[model samples]
Target: MEAAIRASQAQLFEAQAQLTKSQADWERAQNLMQANSLTQPDFDSAKLALATAQGKVKEAEQQVRVNNGKLTESKANVLAARARVDQSQGQVDASVAQENRSQAGVDSARSRTVGARSNVEQANVALGDIFLKAPMDGVILTRSVEVGAQVGPGTVGFAMADTHHVLVTFGVPDILVRDLKLGQRLDIKCEALPGRTFEGTVRTVAPEADADSRVYKVEVRVDNSKDVLKVGMIASLDLVDKEDSPRSIIAVPLGALMPNKDQEDAYQVYVIKDNKAKLRDVTVGRASGDMMEITSGLEEGEQIVVEGGNRVNDGQTVKVKS
Candidate 1:
């Protein structure tokens, strides 16, 4: 379209040049006719040439206008198409961000226990027997060392696991570790026990990511009083932040919100900072009645202008009413 406009403009310039030359020629012909030097046929031909040049100039100007109009329409269509692409990309990004993030792994305990009777029997032959007791009550799963094989410290005597309250451990990416906290609930599901969902509480979260996997380890403790979950069983964990057990959401009264004139489809509010009302841009989320959820740009315990917002201006000193 731009190329067409340029071509039309070039044609218009050429037509204007021709019109100038024709006018000069017609003037010379008129003077010659009055001085009786030029013939009537030649004078009539000059007049006709002048009129034809004028018509060509008008035609070129019209073509240039038409081409310019088409160019503007084409530009508008391009802008509309780009806007649609941007909107689609934004929706895709939001969906990815909103997706429930979780991780899964197979875990089993490995701590050992030594029987007191076996330790006493070996005490007569050896220099005092050392009895190893497990901290928790559970069944011993494996006994690695034989009886009196000259065992020392750090030897795996017997591996035991607490069945009454099993622990499910997994590793998650760095992004998920931030949201996880102690005592947070997670849904644990074992393949062996179908149609059963056990509630688990977060027991531990590794402070740093593992060097090899680049993920943080998280342990969840679940109630297994029914003895349904066994050792070496695989279980999948679902991080729970559902509506029934919703996480705390920061919100403000609807009256505090004000339109952001500089940006489209954006909002702002005046927050009381240091006894001054300061304008702040905030990303809003789902609204509930008189309260509006703020996804970003606001923190808990920060005071805001919930009433008479129109009277407040940004950076204006304000007094709090007791």
Candidate 2:
């Protein structure tokens, strides 16, 4: 299905390129025909080519649409296959439990119980199938079953989400994914909670990039003790490196640093030493919002120019802005 989609997309591009060339040729033929420089047979041929190109473009577009639908159906088939596997596992577990219960019954019914247990074991081994199990530990978001509903293999019994440690899953560009690691703590801000900021750990970093988008999925797990963060809430997150250790670094406004033109990954900051603007090379770490952590070349209690540092020259005398 994916191959078909790719082929259709290629055909669409080829059709579009042909259409462009055909339109240009048809326009040129029109001008030549008006001037009596082109024969009627040649002009008609250009017109026919334009019409054919237009039809090919339309046909390619429809093929692409059809291929997309087939791709969606293919994905659904994969999900159904997984569901069947889960259901089979559940049935096996139920059979095992029944056998265990029957074995613990009275001595008088021991023979009957033995037969029943053997029958169950045989059925379990022969069929090799079971019902669905909840994928994770969480509250049921939706219950699709009633008291006595005849559920089949693919029937969804319940929908659940882990809200205790609410996960905010988002995609990051492949280029930036190299900097991310599991267990790294990040700061998350929810649109629902205006000024409040929440801390979350990077629970999952997808090893592969998405085929279509070329981005990797990253899930951040935030502790929702008070249930402040709910499911489906839109959140903005700041990815931070655990190596930075924000608590131990001297954080300053991001505006304070100026990029060094001659060097890569180097920045310069103006520090007020004895009331004079002194230039210092600093190694910057992870950034969170307006603040940036200084991993080296800056210390706590040092006065650094946060504003109007762009206009100040290195080692130049600058007035203190009240």
Candidate 3:
């Protein structure tokens, strides 16, 4: 395309040169005719020649114009073609950037895959240790692992009862279950311990009732730091208070309250006052038997006698003393 344009430009330049020469010659002929030095016929012939030369000059000029116009169009086409080339270059650059981004993602995925493979190997090694061995000097609660049986990680090889700390399981009726979160402290006691006391907390609760039964599975996390408790043991449970209830209404028997209410939303013990216990509605927040968080109702230093509140009436005047 460029070669063709150059050729046309050359032709335009040649036409321009020829037109200039013809115009100069015609001017000279006109001057001769006017001077009368030439004969009449010769003058007429000169005039005719001049007119013909002028015509030729005009024709040459027109030819130049035509060639120039074609050249201009060719130049425009070349400019447009170059613009398309530049745009294609930009697209190539963008493709390179995308390729680099994808390469980085692939590298990350490969690293994660390697790490996961290592974890699987570690898990397999742990599973290989099914051979029974005493974890520590302790009594076993119950052993369910047999000589050769495929078991999952959650399988209890043998329960140590750890006697050092205990965990109790129970259900929190739906009526009392609500808004109970993990880590809330609880007071616990077992029939085997009788008067002895324990402490625990809301550990976990079932998301749905068991298929066989409609009770919410609840777990109370207890600490037997003194090694006085064991696993799989039955214990009475009571939630001291719901997270939002007031502290004053959470009082309960140190022996009756267990940190393991399987996570009851809350519980309350109304004190007999003014001769009536009033069963005054209360919101328990947190409790530990000695005292509880009263989210609402009850007051600081109010008489909440725990001895015989079950028989009291609302607003009843009774002996108010701690």
Candidate 4:
């Protein structure tokens, strides 16, 4: 547009120059015609030349005005385009700011969720610590703390006793321990409960002897479903072998029994079958003298190793003595 305007201005200047020269020529021709020195035709020719130059000047000036208007319009278009660009940039900036704010809000919510979950877990632990659960079914004999009382670690909140099954521990000499076995029944007499005899079963017999008393500890489990037996009461039990009414159990020599390596308070014995020593797990009952009762896992007619039984292994070839 500038180029067009410059070309139009140059054309205007050339036309103006021609108009000046034509005016000068026309004036000289008119004076000569008046003095009868120039002819009428020549005078008319100069006047026409002047008129043509004036018209061309007017046309060039008009073109310059048109070119200037077009240049102004082009500049207005450029300004409009810049405005649009600015507006678009502003919108993009606003969108980016909004996205950042949304992300911040999301992160804050996530942090709060984590904190809430931690609080919930801590509350659950505190609730568990607030209540006391008895290890087994029993009655609470004593409660040390009142309601709303503060209790800390190792606080004796309650004293409980299991009335379903009562445990009686007693000491016996080593000679008597040889006859005691698991599941043996004994008559338990409590001094406080007169004329009431609670039948108890032997649960455990000590494997080692006590150094001070040279006695073994025996545990008895007595059923007290009626809640007749009280805790801390003096009780006495009698160990009597029911020999007259024998249970017809399978008995084996004490040497044939070995402690099972995999189980606690369990015994295993080797049985001779087709000249092979096969190890068998057995539950034992009362022991009388040098013989131990095999309550299970052995047949009546089966042969077993009595002497040197520790040297044999399972599934080994063995010779039976005649």
Candidate 5:
């Protein structure tokens, strides 16, 4: 900037010097004209020279103004550069701070990870002192762990289902999945409970498919308040047709009775009325293979026409094949 100012000042001085010489020459010419020694043309020429010199001074001054403007713009550019440097410095500081925090988090997580592993080891050591015990006053149905066995956290010591309140499990087919619901009535029978009848309801259904049996696991909660039922005792799980049952009742297919399909919102079934095939809607209660409950929209002995329903349609005549 200083260099630029010096150059502009030098140009102005040169212009001033030219103006001074023109004035001195013009004065001499004026004197000559006044004495009639210089011609009128010569006097006019001197005057015009003075005017041109003045115009040069004005032009130099205008150039100075332009140079000043350039200097101002240069200063502004410097300030902008400084501001950018400051902004960049702030960003670097913030990034460094964030990196430091990340490093701290990593260190903390490492410590926690070590502590978690230690706690796991300690838990295993403590299990050495903890012995498995029977939970209730009942016969043991299974023994998964023996004396001096090395067991882990998830190890099963034994399985002891309550014998005092025994209930049977059965399958409900997909065809009858719709006719059952929770708390629906069930007719249960066991050779052990001969000459006596036991009543139950659809209790629990599995939420997954059983790959081995291809059937659902359905649970029937029985009222063994009498303590007559025993665990592992096989029994018949009888589901009453929902159609024959009253309102608020449900039935499902026996196969769909598997525990897994219980989570299904509903099941499907077919209805045959007045020699016409109609798709009937019903709610699911519990799953039992090959059969289910008719929670609603059905009645007992209604000629359900279970077989060969795939070929029939609504309002279409279908002869009972068997």
Candidate 6:
């Protein structure tokens, strides 16, 4: 489950980065075409790239929903398995007590006790099979069974995918593969999503190159919890030669930040202070997908307005939507 979650997260982030880039490129092309600086073919290409990026973003969002449902199902199955194990243990204990009380029917009682113990072992095995753990955390792309459906050995009930963290596989030149290593973080960009960049970890480097292509298959894992990246999105990968330390910051969705009318180039968020809208100017930092990092304006644990902010004024009484 963890692995599936990671893969999905990676795919989402990668897709989001690509979408941001593509949107920027498309906008630039639009401006250039209006100025008569860009050729018709170039502008058309940019327009197409933007559309593709939009599609990818939608696909990534769908994958996140599917993966979340599968995670919930798997957790429920684990709980059921534990219950079955406990029930089997109880049966074994009851059988032993019955055997101890029957002196005249010793042989018969002994046979029943042995059978009960065997059933307990079989139940344990069945319980183990019920776990349905994914190799890596991911969405269940296909589910082949319904509730209460009969299943047996070799029955495939569902297809599990790890999209939260996803493997981006691409062919790299044989020479380039030699310089790659496991656990190394790489910078990647998607042509469809033009201006945005994402980070990926080098998970696997194929030992052999394809005979015809003369390129080795390299797989990079990305985190996509932000729901920006998608599986099968085309990406350009590059090694990040230098590593930078990570930073933690409080951030909110872009919808939570509203334009400040009084001050240009400034933003405000309507925080619910004492059950009233307390609008305050905020400093913003880097934007990723739908989230903007709060640099200095908002504090942690404060509720910010996400919807219907325009309907209220500063210090206006407001009720939260159910």
Clash count list over all predictions? 1, 6, 29, 0, 56, 43
Candidate 5, poorest ten consecutive residues by summed lDDT: 252-261
Predicted structure 6, TM vs. truth: 0.35
Could you give candidate 6's per-residue lDDT for residues 1-322 as a string of tens digits? 5455566677788889999999999999999999999989789989999889888777777767666776776666556655655665665556657856545455554555566566556655654554356567566678797544678889898887766777787666544566789998888776557788889999998889765445577888888887677765656655322343566779887667777887644678999987899988877554455566677878888887887677668898887765
lDDT of 2 at 277: 94
Better model by TM-score: candidate 3 vs candidate 5: 5
TM-score of every candidate relative to the true structure: 0.31, 0.32, 0.29, 0.35, 0.31, 0.35
Q: Can you tell me which runs of candidate 5 are displaced by over 4 Å?
A: 1-132, 148-155, 205-216, 240-322
lDDT of 3 by residue, 106-127 (tens): 5555555555555555544443
User: Model 2, range 1-322, lDDT digits (tens) per residue?
Assistant: 5555676699899999999999999999999999999988789989999999999899889878876765665555555555555555555555556755543343434444455555555545433232234567676688797433677778887788877788887666555678887998888887567799999999999999766445577889899978788887766666544454425668887668777877644678999987789988886554556666676889888888997787678888877766
Ranking by TM-score: 4, 6, 2, 1, 5, 3
Residue 283 of model 3: what lDDT?
49
Q: Which of 4 and 5 is the better model by lDDT?
A: 4
Model 2 / residue 28 / CA error / Å? 67
Please list the C-alpha lDDT of all candidates, in the order they appear.
0.72, 0.73, 0.56, 0.75, 0.62, 0.72
The list of candidate 1 runs beyond 4 A from truth reads 1-136, 147-156, 240-322
Lowest-sum lDDT 10-residue window in model 4: 123-132
Better of 3 and 5 by lDDT: 5
Residue-wise C-alpha lDDT for candidate 1, range 233-321, written one tens digit per residue: 75665443233355798988766888798864467999998999999998765444446668789999898888888877789999988
RMSD of each: 38.8, 21.3, 44.0, 51.9, 43.1, 22.0
Q: After TM-score superposition, what is the CA distance of residue 225 in candidate 4 from its true location, in Å?
A: 2.3
Q: What TM-score would candidate 2 get against the native? A: 0.32
For residue 196, what is the lDDT in candidate 5?
A: 68
Tens-digit lDDT track of model 4 for 1-322: 5555776799899999999999999999988998999867678889999999999899889878876776676566556555555555555455556765666555655555555555555544543443345688887789697534677889898888878899987666554577888998988777567678889999999889765445577989999998888886656665544343545679887667887998755679988999999888887654544566676788889898887778788999999999
Off by over 4 Å in 3: 1-133, 143-161, 240-322
What's the lDDT for residue 121 in model 1?
39
Worst 10 residues of 2 by lDDT: 124-133
